[model samples]
Target: MSLRTSLTAFPRQALSRPNWRQTVKTSLVNYGDQRCGMAATAHPVTQDSTGSKGPTAMVFLNMGGPSTTQEVGDFLSRLFADGDLIPLGRLQSYLGPLISRRRTPKIEKQYADIGGGSPIRKWSEYQCAEMCKILDKISPESAPHKPYVAFRYANPLTEQMYTQLLDDGFGRGKGGRAVAFTQYPQYSCSTTGSSLNELWKWRNRLEGKRANGGKEGEGAIQWSVIDRWPTHESLVEAFARNIEEQLATYPEERRNDVVLLFSAHSLPMSVINRGDPYAAEVAATVHAVMQRLNFTNPYRLCWQSQVGPSAWLGAQTSDTVQNYVKKGHADLLLIPIAFTSDHIETLYELDKEVIHEANSPGVKRVESLNGNPIFIKGLADIAAAHMRSGQTCSRQMTLRCQGCTSERCLEQKKFFAGPELSSLVR
Candidate 1:
């Protein structure tokens, strides 16, 4: 069967399994070590001279978390310093360091509570490797896809990933293609946009104006982007399946009545007012998941993890949970809709802070879509479709926010969109 056909039939096959959870867990254990092992080793890339589009670099992008407690200080420092995410402006140079230093100790304890660090790195490696393996088989034109993780805040950063691409025989004068695949399902200037800008910045610094005068489609790693996939069918299915699993845990009669609280990382109201599409895209994911679930349970979208208290987008997840429980509506399922994998937000903020304070058994969380085979397959499908389309970035990615003022945003979009920049730019 074709990849599309298999994906269409996946839900039916999955639903037939009596112990789906156990089955998935068993597969995850068997798959994790192998994929993670592959990610650690460097492999040489050789292009096929016989008309093959092989040896493509598939770079996964995200705002990565610290892997250990000791790294939390650096993580927060980089995060605060990012003008795209926080935008402290002129005070950025001064206040960024001061704020990060003050918050590091508290953040360290939070990371400690979750474990020693975030499991983001582990899951990201596994997912990307596994997806590339599938991409090789299904999209043989883009075969031999090498998986590389580029984190914005932590190790294996954008610069490091780009350098590795060069070292691995990608773009040092020999022309090749590399896709900046954002792991964020939704499009947001603060998240995916920031990462792309950083990538563009490093590309200029490292590659310089040597190959074709830094023009795309010449001698550089001809870049493309899988910018966003908020409402992809496979994504919606994976989320719906996880929710169904959680719903099964409750008593049969109460299951239908349980409130589905779809939570995402909160953005500042200022950012929202700037016409960032993250909130709308997040809501689209929630709606798609609910439609997949047949709308059996009541649901509301809430925001979480707001910092510095500068008027964030709400109804806040924590407050919503508290108020709902206070009104005697105790059965609530918190789904971290925005994040594909678990990190401090899900492990510490939602689990430790919100649910713990709620002090009720009904306030539980759906598992993050980490290492989910369905989700991985979804990612592969998305990439395959993009490769087949031969598009630079999504058309949605070409348009800047109405209130966007940064020259970085303008150039970054132009850089990725390349020759088609004229037609794509609004």
Candidate 2:
């Protein structure tokens, strides 16, 4: 069953009518208050003191997907309109909306093939919830670490998440801080850049409102970015461990010969040419995971999810699979190196399309790092490490893009640099 369908299949009781109406009324009131710019003191969502040092919120950012076939067009519209992904210098205002509307049906069909929505959001929520539990236990100093999701081009967009954090009394004072962690395992100017840009724009707007005669109790926010961690120890270990576990499922004698094919989402060749470190970082991640596994097996890193006629990073994954098959390597194991959770890219593209194209009984795919205990611990460790040092963009996690002249790579830190206060406070 589709996730939406399953979720709505619960038995309804007439006895609950009054309670449902009350709940709906309360939500409408809250929504109305927010729309009206009611002062924070009007109806603070949290009971905690706004001026007090608040809980450190770890806000994860990503490109969210449509929840239903109906939303596919809207999702595509937002994505295409983004200048970071598709730079339409002069024609963006007109051409952008045209392209999105034109592509909706085809995209909607794609969603219908894969259970009518992207499961990425659900998996991300699961991962974050699990990570929250781990953070609470291992780092009691940062015990009340709250997890928030900020999507780039969909519902729960950065603005909504910002409003939510404000409502929760998260960003108010000197010690009040939040972590803007990119959920993408490998960094790219397009994915991470687009999301962070939206967030900063929202922050600027809020600050502008405050500066222009807004209420004092409205509160100011401070936040840091967990920009990149392509080679973190725990992350490497998680991938290596999952690879090992998946490999064991194959016949013992055949495991030694199985090719490890790591596939990441492709970006336009233009981005790589302009010195985005994404491709290199992906290679580094694969290398680190391989070192951890200590495997002598043949492996190849390829790119997938190419869109548009523009040149994209090649050794296209589908082409790679066919080439390897022709070379007499039947036993294959596909690992989604870049994606952290099972989303449309993994569930539909790789799991369905690529696997079908390979058309071999020997082909298999390992599970993504969704709600994996070890992986969640790894994420917790990343956040905890940042919270300890009282820095938003840590030197330890930073990578210099080769041939990179673009300011997008390092601009977030300079723009969103927060106060130097320990976010590890409970």
Candidate 3:
């Protein structure tokens, strides 16, 4: 959908309503029926019952985790190898494989701070559980509470989760036909597109390893991927309103002087050089909030967590702080644009390192947008809207031309496009 689609204005009623999850779920169901074409269009896989058959709506939640609990080097390599963690068509291609390798040690040290690695796997599971319950409550009649599963790109429970779901009868039909769901909010290469490639890979291997492994047993289990929800209105409203509160945190005099520093998970410069829309989407979200806020305060976007040998998105938060300091600007506000919820990157990089930069720069203060009520409500609203819509979003990719709708996986340059005059170079 076009990013600017305006949704019906609704009050940000996140926690106040009864069974907020259920309300959102019901809304998603109705909204899906109206906008996305649902109910009659929805699939009911089994023509005949097999005792344990379920309504078909298999979703795959692709996320990052602390796969670093193991020896740092091995885990780091494996994490990069999985290739699902970065935003597909992101800054990484420009940064190249070497950057990922070089950054592993630094990543390991950061993980060490949070007790060996991130609890991404654990927290992802938490998100999954909460979503499943919300879906069941809101759309009990829609489907038989089709199970929602979580998978990771960088940590424990990798491709195995997909296999387990298949085994659990997602494709128990006579044919090798089943649909899959993706649980990432935005569609970028590293998140949705890359995860699908991994899923397809697992399916190929299973097809070879097991006797007609992924083939829908009685019938093919339909493969439907829920790639992203980039332009959903509730999502936008949620985020827009959340940003409003972050702006409110500062005092009147400091408010106008403060700058909103939107930060997202950073990849290499090569990816953006090639053509990843991740940074664009981030900017769009920020602009959307600005429009919603109707504020004239200056704002900027920056990248963080530059891991690997190749150059990643510039103005690493630290560098951004330095640049602002050098330019003689002090007040800054950090808004994590990429992640829907808080993860390790927030705790370590933004919270710890950025704080250090704020101190070093002698700035007034360094504030983060984490734990803001509106932000949390925005997340809940996005999830609720998606559950109601019941349709997958358009996937993101890097294509050379509209003439050839193919994504060419080209190699990227190193040294960060290296040693640039400015850290915040676009």
Candidate 4:
């Protein structure tokens, strides 16, 4: 099929009860029927090679890609936004600190399980670099250029890097043509939304800098983003491959016996009750993989990395494992479907916390899947999709469920040009 680029329209708010099952079913069916949207058509999703007036860059940024050292004070301060104490209007502000202080020591101890801190920053850098190289390979024409993967939290983007890309342009470059994309496999109000929020800051700054610089570039420098790829074929195929690899870690005969549990970051019950499609999206991703893998054993979905005083997303892994154990099952496997790589949540939380908490010896070994070729291809698939499609429209375009709300949506932050989501406290 000929390539189809340019999004028909930006996804609006998802309706209250849009039946997530049906939403994902349509995307999966449409994608599987054929590899329809494959070309880097339109203006280019991540990196625009239009050779136009502005630069188009593909930034695979994350919440915490720490290139710079984290500031302990700032982290805590942000953790307790609008000052350390006070029952402010911000629920996350009040609840986050209350939970953080209580959980920090324990969380720190767990983090130590992974040999210090969440090396999320380190791994993010790795993923970004890997993605950059990956995109360069697929787009080739993105020549004389490369995608820049930066962190939004731990390493908060620096002014220099932002200006460099915005000034130089991404798409084709120097011709008011730059395309940007986010590399989150699954969309969440927290992850992909937060990163895009970060980009908007720089975009605003660039507008000011440009005005002051006297219009060196022409026309508006446009940028596009791939918000999330919950059901992209590349993602499902790659996740299946990853699961198969972990199954291989078991004996060939036992592979079939290995029960599958796909876990993503747990959200709050309030959000889900309010209609956050996050849980549904996570389930959708798992479903896609299971469909592709053709799972014979029972497949299940659970929540991981739950936080805050209020109840977070449900069906804790431990609880789920206990259910399995009660069912006369001994061996069980968990796949962290949310995260891109082996971060603190994966290494400590699942591998250590849940394991030891459940079975006497914990899990035989919480299998690890990171930066797999298929997963990388999934990232590439999304980028390529955006390039051909132009916009990142969602199944619930006209409406967004409660959890579908972007944490960065209309939220403003003051960039310190240093690490740590600057002004998170404010």
Q: What is the lDDT of residue 72 in candidate 4?
A: 33
* TM values, all candidates: 0.93, 0.81, 0.68, 0.70
Please report how far candidate 2 places residue 30 from its true position, in Å: 25
Q: For model 2, which pairs clash?
A: none
Summing lDDT over every window of 10 consecutive residues in candidate 4, give the lowest-scoring window.
1-10
lDDT of 1 by residue, 1-426 (tens): 243574763566674435555655676676665656843545577555222776788999999999999999999999999988897879999999999999999999999999999999988887888899888888888888989999999998999999988888887778788889999999999999999999998888778554346553335688899999999988898898889989999999899999999999989888999999999999999999999899999999999988885889999999999999999999999999999899999999999999999999999999899877788988998898998898998888999998998888887898888786645765
- Which scores greater on lDDT, model 1 or model 2? 1
Return the top candidate by TM-score. Answer: 1
lDDT for every model?
0.87, 0.73, 0.52, 0.54
lDDT of 4 by residue, 249-275 (tens): 777776678778777777666656756
Candidate 1 residue 195 Cα shift, in angstroms, is 0.4
lDDT, candidate 4, residue 34? 34
- On residues 177-292, what C-alpha lDDT tens digit does candidate 3 reach at each position? 23344545555555655566565556545543344754423443444444455555545555655555565667777777877777777866655665556677767776776676
Candidate 4 has what TM-score?
Answer: 0.70
Candidate 4 off by > 4 Å = 1-55, 65-88, 91-103, 158-178, 206-220, 251-254, 360-369, 392-398, 402-426
Tens digits of per-residue lDDT for model 2 on 15-103? 14355446435644564464468735433334253324345677889999987898888889998898777766688888889989998
Q: Which stretches of candidate 3 lie over 4 Å from their true place?
A: 1-60, 71-74, 82-106, 146-152, 174-184, 207-218, 360-426
Global Cα lDDT for candidate 3: 0.52
Candidate 4 local lDDT, residue 419: 27
